[model samples]
Target: MGAADARLPVLEGGPLLRKAFPDHWSFLLGELALYSLLVLILTGVWLTLFFTPEMREVVYTGPYAPLRGVRMSAAFDSTLRISFDVRGGLLMRQAHHWAALVFVAAIGVHLLRIFFTGAFRRPRELNWVIGLTLFVVTLAEGFAGYSLPDDLLSGTGLRIAQGIMTSIPVVGTYVAFLVFGGAFPGHDIITRLYPVHILLLPGALIALLTVHLILVFHLKHTQWRGPGHTVRNAVGKPFFPQFTASSGGLSVAVAGVLVLLSALAQVNPVWNYGPYRPDLVSTGSQPDWYVGFLEGALRLVPAWETHVAGHTLMWNVLLPAVVLPALLFAVLYAYPFVEQRITGEWRDEQHFCDRPRERPVRTGLGVAGTVWYGVLLLAGGNDVIAQTFRISVNALTWVLRVALIVAPVLAFVVTRWLCRALTEAERHRLAEGVSTGEIRQNVTGGYESDHEPVTSFRPGAPRRQLTAARTGTPSRTPHEPEHPDR
Candidate 1:
């Protein structure tokens, strides 16, 4: 046999090679995340060559004149060198940061598509859980990267993080000591986080991504229900030529876009923030965008704390920093099962997806959660927003605080109503075609409007009946005999 024939799957005739992948644009969201992650990995490897993840004190004498004689962490010093001294190092750094942002955002939108479509139901629950775990780890990985630069803003964040850790009632302080390698701004936090940011977390993320792709390949993808689409069959492009080109081209395009963004837009200039000094504070410092939600939550939380039996409980820190995220992630991890429980549709296989209009409850839930998180994220930037809009920071905080309470409730109610309304309207349109903007005069000389049924939906005939009629086939019902002449 020739080389091509020899590589064939024995007697299977390359059956697995032609696996179908749904061609919908929504599917690109997952590919966007994968491509962004690839960018992160590539730029991260480059960064590792110059990054010094040590917290040793050093006097800066680098090219950046702002902190010429100031003492800073070695990690921060290296960051400055990477920005100013190393050629293209700043570009790569920004590329990696931007890639991380897109990665999380793509994952978030992908989850929305999967959830609203009921694609996570039956045989896909495990994949959903795996995706959730990946999200948690991705968030942690971003946080680790954010902290590695050892700038003032990141150090302040670390201090706040230590406070949250110590608020765990009993074991919090011990956990903080163990993780921090000692007390606040411990001697070796950057060294500790280096392995996690560059090695451990990335390793876990890649391994999980492998398993996720394997499962997706094995289980096949879910497509919308339509002609020739069902539990056993999907309608889409093949894997070899069309899908490969489209997905690969899109990934490369996204990487190029990130490169352009990095070149044009400066991000996270650590030199400007200076080194992490426990006593010094910058007025307008802010964390990365992904970390903004937590910052907002922390700001919105009421100032409350308690002490029981000498164990202090910082409720303010605990609620927003610890309890809130924990609860939200718990809900996220359990959402597929929760939806299944509520709907009571325990089918083993689902090859078709539900339109958003068909799943009002799930759609409403998604909208509510998105609104709540978005409000929190905006709250994180309230300081900047207030200054820009010339409003009081305190006033903006209160507005977002009230929004945090009322927005989700309002979003849920409004979304449910809208979905139900749209669904009913769609049903009507399906039964009776849209207005043709034509009117006719009756015998009595009064104008009467006329309605037309869609071509496929002939009043009494729905899709099922229409298909049977066109195919000249009868369904499970007995049909009256047609005359031989007819």
Candidate 2:
């Protein structure tokens, strides 16, 4: 048998694969995530074959040679080799980075869709937790992957992490030292993160994803629009050859596009930055966007010092790095419960979904979260903003602090209003015909078409059902000829 034929599944057919699935645009979010993961896997496989996950000092012998014999991590040298020497290696590396970026973005947007639509309610809470875990793991995976390069950027990030760790009281320094395997410029640091990047985090992510998919299959998908939103049944098609084929096709298409982009465009050109050097501080360096919020927080926090028992404490560092993140994650983990309590809904009676407008408070919280993240993202480029706008760094930090508080409230209020307006508009449309733009004179010489009533039905119900019967036709009498079946 031919290789392709040899892989065919042997099965007794129950239904035609082509006819079993729905082609809905909303389903594309999951497809995008899946596609990015496929690209990640492909690029990662190639990278793993060439990479040396070691932290030993090495002499760089690649295209870039500003500091050839400076003694950098083996992982960094291997990355340099991959970028400069191996055929198509740079493209693969860029593709891998882009894939990780896209994967995280897709999952985030997907979560927003779930939250706004109330898909995280009730039976789906576990799935929501799974998704949140996946998101956290994805972030960790990205951080680990970025750090494995041991570039100036990665080094800076490690320093930030160490700072965050050491910001804790008492045991903070010990924990940081333990994690990094010594002090700053610790030799064992990259070595520790190497396995975490390629193995540990990825394994955990895969396992969580497996569980996530199993739960999704069990619960089916939550849908939008029509009476379907009110009903518990999946308002969609079966998951068979149709969804599989289309999703597969989309994955291939997205991967192909990313591959082309990676090959044609440049990203993360760390060669220009040379290797990680402790003594030399590079200007205009920044962490990746995903980690920018913490950086922003660090910048905004006012410097302070306190002393107790002959030990000094820096409240600025502690608040931003340790307390802030703890607060954020604690809120995230507590949401399902907090919301359930506030809404006075018991776990057993909860549905798998909610319409965005149905839960105004939750939707508002989501919008506020986005605004908070966005402010931090902008703050990540604070230097750029200061340079561009001719402002001082301190002034910019103050502005960001004000914005961090105000922006989310504004965003929440505006989003809540807009969602309500849209819901009302939908309700109005269902109750009445499209509002006519023009008026016409009737045969009786009164304003006609504009004032004409197309149908009269109660608002918030399907139009097609009651359009003809006003309040809907009464059930036929038992003696009626139409009631023969009854």
TM-score per candidate, in order? 0.90, 0.85
Clashes of each: 0, 1
Return the TM-score for candidate 2, rounded to 2 decimals: 0.85
Residue range 1-486, candidate 2, lDDT tens digits = 233334555322332222223245765886798779878988998999999877788887666768566677788899988988999889999999889888998998988887776667666778888888898889889988988888887787888888878878888999999998888878888778878887898889889988987776656665543332333444455455456666778888898889888988888887877678776655777776777888888887778879889776879899987888779877877687777666655334343345566556677889899899889888878998888889897788888989999999998898888777766776665556544567778788998545224453322233333333343443221221110000
Off by over 4 Å in 2: 1-23, 65-70, 227-232, 347-355, 424-486
- RMSD per prediction, one decimal? 5.8, 6.5
In model 1, the Cα lDDT at residue 281 comes to: 72
User: What C-alpha lDDT, on a 0 to 100 scale, does residue 86 get in candidate 2?
Assistant: 95
lDDT of 1 by residue, 1-486 (tens): 245445676415545546788888999899999999999999999999999989889999999888999998899999999999999989999999999999998988898889888789888999999998888899999999999999998898888888888888899989999989988878988999999999999999999999999999878998764445556665787776778888889988999999999999988888778998999877777887777899999988888988789877889899999999999989888888877766665534555677776667778888999999999999888888999989999989999999998999999889988888876776677666534568999999999776655443322124444455445444212221111100
Candidate achieving the largest lDDT: 1
Model 1 residue pairs with clashes? none
Q: Candidate 2's C-alpha lDDT? A: 0.74
Flag regions of model 1 displaced more than 4 Å: 1-14, 433-486
The most accurate candidate by TM-score is 1
